[model samples]
Target chain A: MELKKPAMAGTTESSDVMITLRPNPEGGIVIDLKSDVKALFGDAIEKTILEVLKEFQVENALVNVVDKGALDFVIRARMQCAVCRAAEIQFDWGKEDAHGK
Target chain B: MANELMRTSLYAGGTSPVKMIQAGFYNEDCLVYDLEDSVSAGEKDAARFLVYNAVKYQRPAGKYILIRVNGIYSQELDEDLEAAVRAQPDAIRIPKVEYAEEVKRIDEKVTAIEQKAGLPVGGVKFWCNIESYLGVLSAQQIATASPRVVAMALGAEDFTASMSAQRTKPGWEIFYARNAILMACRAAGISAQDAVFSDINDPEGLKKDLEMTRALGFDGKTCVHPRQIDAVNGCFTPSPKEIRNAQRVLEALEEAARNHTGVCVLDGGMVDKPMELRARTTLAKAAAAGIKVGGVK
Candidate 1:
């Protein structure tokens, strides 16, 4: 299910997450995301993780991904983070602390 | 790869040890079964449970038990790993280790499971199959991240597809990936295993390929069929001469210990260090082969 759909019962917007990815020169990829809540629904989360992997172009590279919360914006940010990590380019996306700049 | 460290390992290809046993492969020592591939799509859960139950009992002949879980990135991977944690086979095989983070994720998952299961943690080992192109790329980081990792393996069939080198032998086409992975495993102090030779009928071909793999730095090869085990065993097992050398090393070391000398010289150099390890491992392997050694057989 799309993270942005109306919050299902017992669902919290804060529980959703979005990921960004980028290239890393270490012959791998990296990921960044926002997961305000730690409600890891196991299998459900795997669907999204796999999707993000598609963009990383998983060739000769290492990947690092971080999670925040459920936000479409967060997903984009995660992708961006992955790119930076894969490229060995570091960017701050901590929502404000020298990141998100 | 003949110069590569040789270890004997077996595969079940996602089947239960029982199935392997029923098929006559499990009774042989040094055999292992996979919990991830080969099983029908629907039977994974049941097969996993069966494997777990089987682990509660001793495997056929002190066989080295290994469970290959689905790629950790899969939707069911976490669950599969969790099931295995409680089962605690000899080792947990992480399929498609595409990056360092995946290995870290596996390490963390295994740790949490060990703690939650109330099992004294830290004994389960990792067997990472560097199958995909991405897996090969991150092979170094992945192999070294987990302290529990005992070895890394190649998944040529899938990797061939990924690299579009399908059905081609001259693996040197992916020579860089192969060398890099082998080097990584060596740097990490773990065994590097090779995947199965699919053509079961071509025993000669299989033997030839293994010679290359052994030369390339693989400790052992994974087998898809039971018939292939003999060749794998033959390739990896310590030869009579090597065993004799190991026994010699052990005896020399023992005499030094008996003399109360912390260490002694051997082969015209400091034989203290390598001699001890080689001696013990030799003893262990000899024991595995039913040969008795001083104080350990």
Candidate 2:
């Protein structure tokens, strides 16, 4: 799905991550991440962000994440929220995507 | 068809893992991860995902985990059910349930999810929140609507608001509706849970309400805060004296049954069928509450 506007999700609470997304017409994903635990989990956190974006097949967006020791699931949820909001779509896990076929 | 004592079912918002984890560790009989009313519209998706993962991963042991999904009419109901069923909590509580068909439909959706996930069919159960006049009137049908429904909780605040009434400490305003719900659940042979006592700071007020519900034969009470758990559990837990009396009655009844007699005597009083049933129920409640009854090692 194509992005319709800038969108964000998640909270700044402990063990949560706030993700913001903007439409990028460049047709590829760009990520800028900030985390307090960057020294130890930087690469792993970035990997999770990319994997979540790839799962949604989001290829054209500028994704920025501010992490606060969020677990993998929190990151996944926040990113999914950001993508859906930016694309102006509902993230109904009930629906089958093209990939489900 | 004995109902378990869910002494406390604590409600926590889906987005707040901090609060949820606190509730889980508090040893309430059940922990309700709420996505309805508690989460803002924009954050529903995030809350669903968070609650799903929490149920799947961080579920506190020894507590029944339940998720309160959005109401049947909400646009988010399908996805909430989709996420909740996959996570596989003990049950999904349906808010604002007014019709029996609503439960049947959600049951169908849960069944489909179970099939798709290869879990046991009918593994998840439902707890209907009866909040409106229509719901209270049809409570019996809603209670017996599906075998999957194990409990019915009254949403008193919303119910009073619907009737254009206000809450009082003595609870006279809601006495009839409350009793009606209790009768409906009792008739259907399911658990009846009392509504929350919103004033968390007033232990005396909560105790008064709990006493009323207990006297009315409610199985438990829903809690909005962790501190309320101890008080709720206390009201439901059988005292040692109560347990001992129950044990004595059972023992006397056993002796009479051995002799094939129609009547029994305990403490110079007749021990009949109704008394025996009450005694048995008391012991069952004690056991369910994890209390050490006499002669039970």
Model 2, chain A: how large is the TM-score?
0.86
Residue ranges of candidate 2 with Cα displaced over 4 Å: A1-4, A23-30, A92-101, B1-5, B116-118, B259-261, B294-297
Candidate 1 segments exceeding 4 Å error: A1-101, B1-6, B13-18, B23-30, B241-297
Cα lDDT of model 1 by residue, B38-150, tens digit: 76765455445445434433344445677778767666677677767666676888887888887887888888877766667887888888888898888888887878888
Best by TM-score: 2
**What local lDDT does model 2 show for residue B85?**
88
Candidate 1 chain B lDDT trough over 10 residues, lowest sum: B1-10
TM-score list, all predictions: 0.60, 0.90
- Model 2, span A19-98: residue lDDT tens: 99999987788889889999999899889888877777777889888898887767877787788888888765644222
lDDT of 2 at A49: 84
TM-score: model 1 vs. ground truth: 0.60
